[model samples]
Target: RRSKDIRFAFDRVFNEDATQEQVFAGTTKHLITSVLNGYNTTVFAYGATGCGKTHTISGTPDDPGIIFLTMRELFERIQATEEEMSTDLSISYLEVYNESICDLLLEDGGRGRSLALREDQNGVVVAGLSEHHPKTVREVMQLLLLGNKNRAMSPTCANAVSSRSHAVLQVNVRRRPRTASISSNVTVATMSIIDLAGSERASVTKNTGGRLLEG
Candidate 1:
């Protein structure tokens, strides 16, 4: 027999004992500051089926997750600087399934018209997608709950409740000096938190037809 060695490097690695807070602080906490400084940021998880992608992105109520933690810190910072900076926060959630985009924030469970992607000055964006202004972290979490309820899910041999799509939560932040003149420039940025669908192999997941195609 012949043996070969392969090595890979990463910025950081976490073990099963690592708490959600530790993971968030080490990996994603810095992005919140960037968003406030008018820089776009995104955090996403990708891996094979049943690898804890969803659990890391959206944890249980008792033990919250990255989304909740990020929102809490964002709101706290906004409140602390309310007198110096007037800020606005808006959020939109959507999913990509089977190469199709659906607005998860839609009242009709994202089954209405199809959404298209277009590029603007900022970057690529979903055209005609709905956006909601949330005043507090609780409100933003409510919106998240609603969107998750509408996300696509299916059963597979690898995992019982497998996510069938990529779920993206977009938070738009706009800020201006509270005492600035009307002509003063306003800083705007977007933070995207995405939970990607897990990869699957037909032999392992036992998927067929549509599910297989999604994988």
Candidate 2:
């Protein structure tokens, strides 16, 4: 066999020994500042099956991950500026499965209904998606847990309880001067955190029909 070389570049790279905190700091910490400054930000994890994407995005209670750390920092910054700025935080969770979008925050996890996407001045959005205003990090985490329970999951030969869809959590932030006049402008931004489904190979995963289609 002939040998070939390929080179790739990234903003940053992590080693296997990197802790969750280290990963978040290197990859996502700066986005918090952008969100606070009224700029949209997004962070997503992609990899092959059982590669720790889920763990990094949503770590266990004892070892909380990016979601928890980000929320905690966001709330802290907002609180620090509460005297001068009034801020509102709204969260929406959804899943993309089989090329269909479903609201994971709904009572029944939006079963039997495929949501439509529409474009507005703010860009693309999911119509009829529910948004919940969370006042504290704990509240935000509670919502995350609920959404996770509703997320699409299934067993696969590559890994049991594999996520079968892409999970997206959007945090919308609106802020305005606390003492601003009626004509004052408000700043709006969104921070989207996504846990993408792992890439699959049918030959290895042995997925069939729906699962294969999803992959």
Task: Report the number of the highest-TM-score candidate.
Answer: 2
- Per-candidate Cα RMSD to the true structure, in Å, reads 1.5, 1.3
Error of 2 at 200 (Å): 2.6
Q: Write the per-residue lDDT of candidate 2 for residues 1-215, one digit (tens) a residue.
A: 99889889899988999998999899899999999889999999898779998999999999888899899989999999999999999999999999899999887899899899999998999999999999999999999888899888989988888998999999999999989997898999999999999886778789998888987
Q: Which pairs of residues collide in candidate 2?
A: none
Among these predictions, the greatest lDDT belongs to 2
Report the CA-based lDDT of candidate 1 relative to the real structure. Answer: 0.90
List runs of model 1 lying over 4 Å from the truth.
1-5
| Local distance difference test, candidate 2 | 0.91
Candidate 1 C-alpha error for residue 63, in Å: 0.8
| Candidate 1 worst ten-residue window by lDDT | 105-114
78-107 per-residue lDDT for model 1 (tens digits): 999999999999999999988888999887
